[model samples]
Target: MSRASPAERDERLDPVRWHRPTRGTTLRLISVAVLLLTAAAVLWFKPATCTPLLTAPGPTASSTGKAAPQSSTQNQARDQTEGKPAARAIPSGSVGVPIRLADPTALSVVRPGNRVDLLRLESDKDRTTPVANAALVLEVTGADDPVLGGLLLALAPEEAKQAIATTGRGFAIVIRPS
Candidate 1:
């Protein structure tokens, strides 16, 4: 045969025919598959005792050895009976003795007359003193009764002073008229 040019020789040696995979390639693929199967079998068949990653601590006895006793129905009934009020007492007021006028709208009332200053006491520490130049209405019961007057007068000077000072201990029915 006559000698072919370099380009012709290259054309005759087809890349598709030269690059085909062989038996060695098939052996390599099989080896990889076997290795993967062996690893999976070892993981599945291995003897392992699985311990809990997180375990709760066991409960302990309370410091008080005895459990708290529950209240009985009978005990509750007895307590209710003992705490009940016997009766409600009525309230009274008299004139010139700082008779608290019943006025829901007014915060406090000043008794009319010389040295007649009935001040409504406020618990707020900032407003302990009566607000100056503020007008408030007084509500007073006009029913005449000497007993109420005597009762108010009978109170000790200190007690009377205290009663006049604040609204804490006074009868709830008696309120400064607004």
Candidate 2:
């Protein structure tokens, strides 16, 4: 081995260089980075090993009686009213009733299947009193007062018992023109 020279190749001690790190090489690089982060947190919280690219199957009402496939983006924001389509906005002996809106900007054009009336108000101001005439807006919640909002309503059963006995004495949501 007599031909290596440029001053022994720049004072070589190279075994692919990186060496000053020890405490047993930082405990074997922190045990291979905690065993690759506990195997990526057990495959990222296990229990879901596949099979779900559009799973709609759990509503068996008795395994095979049939009836489960309504999703045209929920009838494309329904509201044909007399043409009856937003999946009958809760009409099957209805009784949902949540209502709390007294005007939180009319729950931003209330949706989920329009058709409403609700009124009742009168808490120290302009009188109004109808409490459920049309009612069917099946869900529009979001009210910590970013302009008031909350109205589940599906009524009928004596208008869900007069809108659940006048839901805490306050109401107001008129939208009925469609």
Candidate 3:
């Protein structure tokens, strides 16, 4: 029945200087470290080319069965090589087509010259199908009116036809890299 000396007391009694990690705690720490390292490695290393999840269709023959003209850049390069006075290059393949967006907020995001993919909401479940692939965003009208708040797009003739036909259905725009 006497108090023990400080030096004779067990170190476990000194709560501040002791740490005992449970198995679950150690496993959790290891798992977190592994996850962090894996994330870092994935961020640091990337593939040379990123593959597109869905392929977009380019301008094809128009509804009239006439094939579309080549893009300006290609024509300019050809003209330069052929030694013809670079004819005033014209944008011929795509034409402006108007389509309303189901979501009004979507109108603010699109701008002229931005490449976009058009999708149609197919069912009540929100499933979608790509209607126009890699079409150029020609213009966006900043109107909140449900029917008027939409975008004007420069799409191939076939895509224009598809877009015109798909207007009644729900439309969603997906912006793409130029």
Candidate 4:
């Protein structure tokens, strides 16, 4: 063979440049894009068919309806057992006397037509006692009868009356005539 010309040698040694991408490379890139798109869709959108973990039950009838009658009966029995006697007021024809005060050693008198005040006083040991403060009124029982001397006495119902009457205005002090 004869020696090749310089131009021919240059043409043979030049590199071949491709204008379009390779089929395998294009397919791989497209597949990667598709995978990324599927992942994004899964993150952004949730399926409506999925059910919640917890659901509330529908309304039901009350459980306590049957016990009402028994509860009322129990309440009535409690009231009957705990009932106390009603306090009675001192009678009018009877005189009121202060019996026991906070201080047992002290003596105090509450005459008729006067007021008495009662207060609760507590001792050092936490025991409480009722103390009475009295006001006295002096009046003669009978003025016309010479046989019956004019005597300073407290007000009370007539001796013949069987029941005593309480005035109810002042503190209760029950006294018997001496």
Candidate 5:
């Protein structure tokens, strides 16, 4: 046969192929499938939930003076099985005191069930004094108002008086560790 030009030789040598997908297309499909599987795994997986180690004490049956009486045999069985003395009932009567924070942004770090120490700020003397220690945070109010964020603290009657008294002089809260 006569020698053909390079362009003509390339055209004749090229094979007549059907519309087959390229390697890049196959790789793209595999990548999409892997991404979908990863998403499904993320959505389907669930973490185990555990109860708190130190939960607040529940209301005591002894408080109402209506606890069921157990026979001596039953009491002995319970004592042996439990291997511990009965816990004393927790005393209740906590008073709520509404105390304002000097910096409302500080309340963002405080949560209900958290304990705080209250302090009184003396503007005239430029001194800070402790008002109450380890006061329970009962409620956080005025959350919508950045400047009016107030705290409702659960305290003993005397402690409540002390916290409320410091409201006029301006108050600050110190978040305590659990």
Candidate 6:
């Protein structure tokens, strides 16, 4: 192939021509800018729910300086043992399982004494599978602060074992309609 003349080559190498935007470039740039702004707006205006429920120190009772309401299971345990202290976290035969949800905000609607269904968050598949159903909520902290949120559930010993086995993985709660 023949080389272009030096003058022609110089013109081709001009920075102005090299840096010029093509016809579609403006559209692409505007779209990207709009996307970024939209993302920022969503994050900024969205409810501030960032903290984990467990971040607060101490048991729920200590927070308000009141004795926690005893569940029927706890009462039964106390009765059976004749003045023995029942477990504070959960009823005698049940387990107190702590779980972190995949999306911390999802726990906002949960509350103590509510029955919730636990699901294992299958991140790879973008879907969750059931882990436990009708688990008793022992304590709840809505994720409105600054870290990953948590929930304390009172599950039967057997179901608790299943939930415990999946610890460190993401979990979510479903509040069943009464």
Which candidate wins on TM-score? 5
Candidate 5 colliding pairs, count: 0
Model 6 Cα lDDT, one tens digit per residue, 56-149: 2233464578865433554436544884322234555676788877777767777666789999877567777788898877766545751556
RMSD of each: 29.1, 13.4, 18.1, 32.3, 13.8, 18.7
Ranking by lDDT: 5, 6, 3, 2, 4, 1
Candidate 1, residues 122-163, lDDT tens digits: the string is 544423333212221222222243233211122334445555
lDDT of candidate 3 over 53-170, digit per residue (tens): 2222345566699876434455445656995423322136767787777676777666666788999877556588788988766556654454556777777888878777763457
Query: 1-178, model 4: which lDDT tens digit per residue?
Result: 9998988876784587456878998999999999999999999998865322211223334466543211223433443477621112233344433222333222224322344334344434453333333323233222234234222222243321211222222222323343
- Give the winner by lDDT: 2 or 6: 6
After superposition, which runs of candidate 1 have C-alpha atoms over 4 Å from their true positions?
A: 1-20, 48-178
TM-score rank order: 5, 6, 3, 2, 4, 1
Please tell me which model should have the higher lDDT, number 4 or number 5. 5
Q: How accurate is candidate 4 locally (lDDT)?
A: 0.38
Candidate number with the higher TM-score (3 or 5): 5
> What are the TM-scores, per candidate, against the unseen true structure?
0.17, 0.32, 0.45, 0.21, 0.48, 0.46
Off by over 4 Å in 4: 1-19, 48-50, 56-178
TM-score of candidate 3 versus the correct structure, residues matched by position: 0.45
Taking the tens digit of each residue's C-alpha lDDT, what string does model 2 give over 11-129? 99787965489699899999999999999999899684443322232442433777664333434344344443343335556767777765577776777678888887876667887
Better of 5 and 6 by TM-score: 5
The 10-residue segment of model 4 with minimum total lDDT is 160-169
- Candidate 6's TM-score reads 0.46
Candidate 5: tens digits of C-alpha lDDT, residues 87-154 = 21112566667888887888777766688998888877877888788987766766668576788777
lDDT of the candidates, in the order given: 0.37, 0.67, 0.68, 0.38, 0.70, 0.69
For every model shown, the clashing-pair count is 7, 2, 0, 15, 0, 6
**TM-score pick, better of 3 and 6:** 6
